[model samples]
Target: MRAFIGMDFDKGLKDELNGIQKVLKINSKKGNWVPSSNFHITLKFLGDISEEQVDAIDRIIKSAVVNTSPLSITLDKLGYFNIRSNQYGVIWIGIKGEMMKLNAIYGIIEKEMKVIGFPKEKRKLTPHITLGRRVILDLPFSQLREQVDHELGKEFLLDNLTLMKSEEIMRKRVYTPIKSYKFNKILEKNHR
Candidate 1:
């Protein structure tokens, strides 16, 4: 299954991002917007793995996240990926606050997965919500960036992490939550 772990956005935060999408849509090219429902900040992208490995991956994830407390993440910046000639890949929302803790969790997941024979990811973990893809126009990237920066200064609480399956739906990629794990401090306190 093609899977990964990520933090989902709350409804209020989704609405805030949708608002930014609306403004960018006015003068933006048709392919420049992503469905707001698909927005999420990925921690790890565990690509295709055998069915036999599913149980081990679950146990590893549970061990890594069981003790950490829920954190608040604010989506405050706008940026692009591989912006050389034109922004072809993504326009995204950036993250702030409690990022160190998030990075630590990602590191633990990467480390544990390596012990089980899964190859380490080649790219560094960059925490951002992908807003759109296949952008084909040279619309004022700077203006769009500035607008997103001004309007999307909202914060949301992240208390849970989910293991998600990414699948093709009518030729478009969609995510489905397979399992969700919550943080419990009492469990950690006892462990220490």
Candidate 2:
């Protein structure tokens, strides 16, 4: 199965992101806007693993996350990926507050998975919630960045991480949740 690990936003955050998407759509083409339901911050992408590995994958995730506390992420800034030209593969918001802790958790997952035989990703980790794809040319970069920044200044709490499955059906990819792990203990402690 094609799978990845990520943090899922609550419905309220999802709605807020959807609103940002609506505004971004004014200057963006149809293909450039990602469906709101697919919005997530990926921690690890484990591509096409065998069915025999499912149990091991679950164990790895549980072990990695069990001690990690829940993190609160604020979405700020609208951004895109491009080396040259305006070929935006992903439009996303930047993460803040507890980002380092979150990164540490992701590192643990990556380390544990590698120890168990999963291949490591070639790309460096950048935590951001993907807002859209397939961007058009001549984008109003300054305005979009401003809008993202304004929205991100508003804070949101994150309490859960999910293991998701990616499947292809009728030429489009669909994401389904396999399991969800809560960081209740992390949130219960005082933020000193």
lDDT tens per residue, model 1, 1-192: 898878776677788888877766664665556677777788878888677887887888788777788777787687778755564577777888888888888888889889998778888878888777766544688777776677865677776577889998998788888877666665336545
> TM-score for each prediction?
0.87, 0.87
Q: Could you list the CA RMSD of all candidates, in the order they appear?
A: 4.2, 3.6
**CA shift at 55, candidate 1, in angstroms?**
1.3
How many angstroms is residue 82 displaced in model 2 relative to the true structure, after the best TM-score fit?
A: 1.6
- Show model 2 residue runs off by greater than 4 Å: 83-85, 137-139, 185-192
Q: Give the TM-score of candidate 1.
A: 0.87
C-alpha positional error of residue 113 in candidate 2 after TM-score superposition, expressed in Å: 0.5
Which clashing pairs does model 2 show?
75-152, 76-152
lDDT per residue (tens digit) for residues 114-151 in model 2? 98787777777888887777766346778777655666
Question: On a 0 to 100 scale, what is the lDDT of residue 17 in model 1?
Answer: 82
